[model samples]
Target: MAGETDPLATEQPPLSAGDLPAELPGELIAPEVAALEVPPELVAQSLGEYVRAWGARIRGGDPGVLPVILGLAIIAVLFQIVSPGNVFLSAGNLVNLFQQSAVFMVLGMAEIFVLLLGEIDLSTGYVAGLAGVIGVQLVQPVTTNFPWWVAIMAALLACAVIGAAQGTLVARLRLPSFVVTLGGNLIFNGVMLWALLFGPFSGYPTLGDQTNPHVLYQLMWGTIDPLIGWIILTALVVVVGGSFWLRDSRRRRSGLVAPPVSLTALKIVLIAVVGAAVVAICNINRAHFGTIEGVPWVILIVIGLLGLWTVLLQRTRFGRYIYAIGGNPEASRRAGINLVRVRTLAFVLCSMTAGLAGLLYVANQGGASNNFPGGQYVLYAVAAAVIGGTSLFGGRGRVLHGVLGGLVIGGINNGLYLLGLDVKVQFVVTGFVLLAAVTIDALSRRGASVGSVAHI
Candidate 1:
């Protein structure tokens, strides 16, 4: 009995980057290798070699952003052709599309925390609702009158505590994340309803009419001045583009593997072009009465958060450990990584991020009502992250993936509305799109595993 071996363990195939290695789907290998060391063959010393390397990755079944780009283009074009008056491509609609997408993007990012560690968060939707109501109630004129910033911080803090509770159950008690978070989802939803309905409030927790949190309302609806838009774009190009250039160039100079100079320049150029395009679009004056224009503040907020989280996940030691744990928990434990602390912290961050999304939802919807669709929102959050290419199995994702996926989800929704499809139809189409993405993910993994065994 003491020497008993697990039959399941013997049949476990092999460890993978985040899942069973079975030779790893090409896309999955990137995270595992990136956390350790870049493969020599994968490193390119010149522009041509870089191009070849990228091609090789695709051939190996890692399509990278290629699928996202192509799928987005197809959606846009199809919608443009089918929508009445071609309004789907109209500048006004496009800007609104971005506004519509803001919440999904943020929620997707929140899910990324535990998702990267091969965990799931079914409770994020109501968690967001609870956080939003707290922020709103804190700023109520009749009672607290807390400053907008203070209210926001309080909301995020609550999210962290919620995350801690759920994470503890999973990380310390070794409970299944799905069950823990599912329970959390129901519990938080009930708490949110209690706060909204039973709690002492002058009215429904509203960011709409409250004079105290006017700035909070403005966050989702307000636009930057046109001149400020250009200035912001310039700053973004210089700051973001410059950082990418400097980091990679420095790596190359130090004899570490990095992209070619030309490639780095290309990336900067693309950034400048895209930023300029967005600003140009936003500046196109879409108002029916008073000349309205400039980028929505939420756009910049998303970009800022993207940069922040990207740095947190890509450049920090904690980020590396998260990836390591996601890829191989036993190995991470063997390597002395504190699985409990890291896992719990990841859940905390996820909730905090989800809280921000909830706050934004308050801004967008004008209030955090008791009827908030936490269930639907959670599904979309998962749909967006997975559609954007974050593996459901984990250890292979980024904040950018969430952003990209948000756009796709946003685009599909925007297009359907333009086509005059019913809300139910929108849901159906979205489900299909999500299904397709998951199917592709599963197939890619299967293909990789078979190939791996053949080689062995």
Candidate 2:
């Protein structure tokens, strides 16, 4: 037996507790040995799981700056395509566009206040018309012959009171805004008619109306020298540059993420280019039979209002409360935000601004007639806001959005006129554009809820 030892016995080791003999077979490895090291396949599986986890995180929705920029680009392209004869691109046309959009721009800012509170003011147009008639009556010699400043103040005060009254009914009595504003609209229209029929309201002041001439008219429509345009442009650049630098410094000091230096510089450059282009365009002579140059004072007035309203909404606590109320009224109340006061103030401001726009409109037109169709213009103001990205649901919009949106609408109007299109065609086209804008807004909101990049 010793001389004939088995070959298998010679290769096998002595079995120990918890150990397997080598002759047991390759497939008979102990479970403990198998568990000591992971297989390459297992490692590959774990890596796949990790990748999927990270992918999910990356797909989450995040607010970004791309949407706003893309919107502006698409607008520019559409206008270019629709009116390719350089008429839309001409310097004179651009200046005219700004002038034409001034009223809507002001109205848009007015709407912002109500929009922030998730409310609407259907009476704005009629209110403006009534205020204009009152303003003209006050300035008329047959009336009290009040100073222009006094008349303006009276008109603004009247509008504010009406607005406050409406707000009280809505906020205190819990009345529906649609019904309240609709009633107010009718009342204001009656007041306008009364003022025109009974009050001593003269037409707008003409160049040679009075012995001293109409200084106010001159101020509104007069042209500035080219030198003045350049000076104003330079001042604007300095102020805007200083503001950006200060903002960046504060952000850095607070350990907040500031925009990249390149991005900041790009913004400044873009602003400067736009300002320069505007100045150059306005400096051109557009007068065919007479001398007309530079921008209208109404243009400055509109821009000033825009800046003021933007600051109010973005920088003030009141503005914050308004937005809060719109977003979540109950939550805002729990946080001690006064819904009544803020809502009232917003309505008052909106009405006063509407008055301002109305005055500007009459001044630009040089007269106001009963057939001015204030109601139609009011609808246009609302449409402009919606088209410019102001959410109907509220708590989201910008003053600049209104300006750009107004310009887009004004451009369409001007372009259609230049192309010799009928007024009916213009109206139809505008209606379609408004519809498209609203559809896009709805789709964007839906996309945002679903974690899609198409939200814009």
Candidate 3:
């Protein structure tokens, strides 16, 4: 054992080596060597290394978000070419597209929590519908008349209770998640229908029937002034982005592993570019009757949630537990993770997020009705998550994947509408795309499995 050389030490790398010190003549001769031997935190210590590492990953069955982005781009271009008058890319239409995308994006994100743990949630649609129903009902003038914030909290709390109940069934009783959530779907749907059809006010509760629409209306319809939007973007780019760079630089100086300086700068640049582009698009006058300029409040809500979820998943122990449990439940249990608590929390968070999506749906639709299309929404939520590059098998995804995937779904829907295509076409396209994504995921999993076996 003392004289034997590591097989890793002798194997060929995918590319020329990184700068990691070598133990032999060509030990670090491959860009992928670091990925194999170096610690995770330092995998991207250089821009070239990041590129090489990601390239290797893609080849090795993990494409990350690249496929989703490419799909979104291709869909955008295709729709732009076919849409009458090229209206798919029009400022007004794009703004409306983003608004329409909010629900799907949020719902996809909601599903990600459970999906990461190799689980599915069928009740999300009705949970969201119930949230909207409860929220709108609570704010009715002749009924509860609760403040908007209180109504929101109440709605989220209710969804959380439902999530906990279903999660308990799966986690504690060892019931199948599909059966548990399917039951929840029916239960919540019935409750929503009853509340809508037989409740105190009416079957349809609106935000502004003699009462103020309040923040509920504002969340979807309100806008940040163009100047203010620019200022906020600038502040975020300079302050938050600068803080990250400083922290990473300090880490490097202290002999700690940190992302390469160039990689960090490139990320900041990307943020600035995307933020600026969003503001520019939103600032364009998109109104037919009057100038409706400035970024929509819904955009901020979506972006804010994206940032929050990204941090929660990437930087927190809870996030790690989710992935660990999802990737290998047996190993995770052996590693001392409280499997029940984490899974329960995942479901709770998923439901609460769906509640938020419900409120947004109400905002966009102007009312909560019995015909919220919860079933269709469930399908779309799963489709968007899958299309966005979140693996169906679990332990591989980001919240941004949901957003980008939502964009693809929204884009295709909007583009088809512009082209006067039937609604069925949209569903057909989405279904085919979802199938392709699932196929890719399955193949990637197999590829990864093969690679692991070869190494072993």
Candidate 4:
């Protein structure tokens, strides 16, 4: 019997792994398996679900700029109540606040470009001064007698070139950004001093005479007509609202988890209210000539710049690369991004924006000065960016954050000035605010890391 082949075991082809079937025996299937069902309400389908998701996101380490906005509102109300006759809430003071925020708004944005790459640019302040001086000299009879706009462009070009060189050192040499930018700050400041002190100037500390064109000066002091402001505001509201709605709808149609239509509408309505308020306030007859002023050019410039930068950072491949690099440099490199180019471009862009800020500063002051405290200005820029909820660790910020932060800073300064607070008190208050912002950033990051670990 052992040597004989049984009828059931008759010789045949061998069963290969591929010949194995997946069908289980009839007894193996569980009866409960057929009863399993997913509930519809458990899935995110309504505005409430969307809000819950946002709350979860916040709890998971993204507090966003909501705190800053709330802080701004709180500060405004506090100042309004404490200040005599609610002077801080006056239209004149509010107008001044917008004008005051322009420099930092630009500088804060400039810092963001580098900050997104987890880098810092300490030289932005001095770079701004140098660029501003160059602009003044070129447009004046004391130098090349170039057009004001040409002078501005040339100055920005110079800043870009300077940034590129420094970036080369940072990207190619792999030097520490803090050290490199520190040296740059000193060098640029020295250059600014030399130019103002000896370079074709009639006197120390300033470039160009009264005979110089007032175009640059007008930047900080000019306002558009009411009609133009209304038109621009309308266009912006309609276009921005439509675009946001369309984007959400498209995402939803494509089966993505887009925000609820109600949320989108709320955002649109809020924007419209704010826009209308600004326009209406500006259109009030405040001038001695009794003419209707629409909006300050500086405000328009800041908004335009904010929009442009938001597009760049949120919608571009270069921006994506910047974030990727900041998140993980090695991963970004392995993904075939040209790390050196992106880093270098970031530095150049930072300096160029600083250069624009410099122009605005000079415009605000009515002339370029060697005595500009660029170091202090840079600190303010950093503070603004941080306070607006941009993470110091990089890769987690938006240009809008910078704008909001700048506004916060401007509001504080304006409110303090109106309250007749001492300069020392202002400094102490600002320091505290900055410290709080940094603390928030640190805590949020730690929380997020912990949350991720728990998930894992």
Compared with the true structure, all predictions reach lDDT values of 0.84, 0.69, 0.85, 0.81
lDDT string for model 2 (149-205, tens) is 787789899999999999898888889887898898889888887777754334333
17 in model 2: Cα distance from truth in Å? Answer: 59
Instruction: Give candidate 2's TM-score.
Output: 0.79
Ranking by TM-score: 3, 1, 4, 2
Clashing pairs in 1: 15-21, 16-21
Number of clashing pairs per prediction, in order:
2, 0, 2, 0
Best by TM-score: 3
lDDT of 3 at 215: 72
Show model 2 residue runs off by greater than 4 Å: 1-86, 198-208, 211-220, 452-456
The digit string of per-residue lDDT tens for model 4 on 319-382 reads 8888888888766675567788889999999999899999888888877766798998889888
State the displacement of the C-alpha of residue 344, model 3, in Å, after optimal TM-score superposition: 0.4
User: TM-scores across all candidates?
Assistant: 0.90, 0.79, 0.90, 0.86
- Which RMSD values do the candidates have, in order? 6.8, 20.0, 7.9, 12.5
Model 2, residue 131: displacement in angstroms? 2.1
Off by over 4 Å in 3: 1-41, 198-201, 209-212
lDDT winner between candidates 3 and 4: 3
Best by lDDT: 3
Better of 1 and 3 by TM-score: 3
Q: Which stretches of candidate 1 lie over 4 Å from their true place?
A: 1-42, 198-203, 208-211
What is the descending lDDT order?
3, 1, 4, 2
